[model samples]
Target: MTTVLWFRRDLRLHDHPALTAALETGPVAPLFVIDPPLVHGRWASPNRTAFLLATLHELDAALRERGARLHIRLGNPTREVPQFAREAGAQRVIVTRDYTPYSRRRDAAVARALEALGIAFHTRRGLLVHEPEEIRNATGKPIAVFTPFYRVWQTLPLRPLHPSPAHIPGAPGLDPGEIPTPASLGLPRPVDALPAAGETAARARLQRFLAGPVCTYAETRDRLDLPGTSRISQDLHLGLLSPVEVVTRARTLGCDTAKFVAEVAWRDFYHHILWHHPRVLHEPFQAAFRSLPWRNAPAHFTAWATGQTGYPLVDAAMRELAATGYLHNRARMVVASFLAKDLLLDWRLGETHFMRHLVDGDVANNDGGWQWAASVGTDAQPYFRIFNPVIQSKKFDPEGAYIRRWVPELRRVPESYLHEPWTMPPSAQEAAHCVIGHDYPPPIVDHTLARQQAITTYERARRASASEPPTQADR
Candidate 1:
């Protein structure tokens, strides 16, 4: 009557549905498998890898506190999970479900392998407030858009929280493999320092945000210069903090928690979108724009990626992401809009770049966000409704604090010309001890010209999607 509990994103013990359910059956052998392809394959991420390794250590220590320890395996989960389960004499393998396209495929393979060995494979709902199948359209498919989904999501009752087990009986006589360091994996330690990882740290951060930040989140969330946001996206990504725990706790505080809860609903919405339409992974959800022409200019892309674009806000967000493996949600929208609309690069390129760099990159959320900015997803911005970079900078980062912190070359530039340093006269530039094209690079592309051209190109694609043949990218 033993079970192998495989931890994926839901790394925590408190409020864990799968862990609680598994422990009810019998003693549990907690397991974590590090797949090679995730660490070294096409979509590898150094920042996330470093963070995961650190979190695994914390999870292991937490298990030891409860008379259990984490078991590690380094290989394909399809092979490793079942192998470890059988070796531990477990009759079943249990996990909290993940909904990405790749995760679904991996889970299916693992289940098939486990079934062949007469081991029951069970998936529990703990990561999201509602699974894809739980909220559906009239057609019985997951809701395609968020508004209708949210309308239904709020009315549903939430399952009560599960208390952590006082004692966990670990499977006897199994070798818990050693956790590997970044160097041992042939990857460099991340330059951006990661947060104190694990459930305890996750809960502490949540408490800090709840103390005061959650009350004014609706008012100050958009100001990019201020630290007004919860900054818990990374913890949510790794499942150190359960969505249910975060949402339920915030509501209990008696603040106007609607907006914050709505944001959580948005996260659940994207997961449901990915669950229903896996094709969104390789193509746009709004199929009409899949064939949309992208300039994909190498020079423009290089400038945008390295934070050398003449626009200060765009540059600051990209640079901040490089330095800290994190960015404010407001900043995320600005840079994403700049990339897809202004630069007219392929949105997928930006998505892949972020996944490779961000510590909190989740497939459903990141893809949905990139596609939204690109104007090619459900509830997306209209392609013609472009973000004027200068206007956005002045509105969201009015004081230029964010730009100054990330782009020090503009620190000496006066407040008047900080957002548009190229506009400063040569004499004024000298007074500030900064020179455009000398100290800081000039704007790579003219926004006015780019804006006009982008609108025309998108209009042309809109027509093509209705009548003319699609472009090669669509094929």
Candidate 2:
């Protein structure tokens, strides 16, 4: 019996769980469905769509080298997959499991459709190093706290990375529709300098990173000016690289590398949180936090989105995100904190924006991070732990190099004033060849006032309902 391997986020052929299973079953039909519900869904962006299509093209070429090919279909997977299965004469379909409210529902619907066609549907854990349910606490509940979850995560033995198939058997040929374009979907063409696509590039990056930069990852991952973290976040998100392969290789390097491996667990930790508590997507993870009044001002959001916020670090980070569809990890935290705390905008607004722009954006990680910064998530930064943009800029981008890199108008400003350009005197600003309101936007909100307001807002909510039994919303 032939098996059809359905490819979703796990786009590559190398070290793929479902692909491996399908290969063992004999000739396999590889399928990719451009589900409209997914492409035009919330948090969707042309950058990710572009990467996906380019990656699919690369995947198809790789499959062709093995006498196999990827079949591209545009529509609902539940309706299209079963039809493809019948056409290919497949008796079973194997897929990597996805965890997210929408994905779970989609998979279930597809399974129901496949069942009626007399085809068995099987899914395996491949996206994460550990299934969210497998490495839980003693009470059989997923850990909401990251440190303890990471500690438990460290002890779990990892599965060996599966090798890519040397020769994937051919699929029954059929019409694989035209590859999608951004315009066809009413989206702009991606302009960001995205990472190279496909498994080949992913493996190369893994080898290159493990060889040189990983040793300093602990020290540098937090520095926005340095290439400390593996920029492989996008690759991992697209399944161009396997989490198993990444963890196993890093483990062989000893403690420093092991620390890097734990960061990978952070990805899983968020996924586990979302799987058990899907409501975090729509509501605050912390219940009391739900009561905090948010100023959903379009003008404020516009300034924030367009990088005209007048806050140097915040604007720089936002501009970087807008221009490249990527932001440094430290910048992500700082900017997120600024948005949800300083501006007092809903974390959901910032969360959705990041998801729309980041090529590496995953709903679980993005939502978890927003809630963390907004002080409404698992192991959230205390509400009082507000990040001062100027301080964060000086601390992380000490030389203001990252700021200057993106906000070039502030290039001539001295290091002391670059982080707080509004603090500069007119002469110093002129001497620096920069004007606060002209060359750069003025700070959108007074940091001092906003900080006090945010603190009071959170404090009042926590105290007023101190006796309210906390829900996952209060995470």
lDDT of each residue in 220-281, candidate 2, tens digit only: 88888888878889898888888988988887885578668878999999999999999999
> lDDT by residue for model 1 over 118-184, one digit each (tens)?
9999999998988788897778766777899999898888889998888898887899999998889
The best candidate by lDDT is 1
Q: If scored against the real structure, what TM-score would every candidate get?
A: 0.97, 0.97
Q: Candidate 1 clashing pairs?
A: none
All models: lDDT? 0.88, 0.88
Q: lDDT at 235 for candidate 1?
A: 90
| lDDT computed for candidate 2 | 0.88
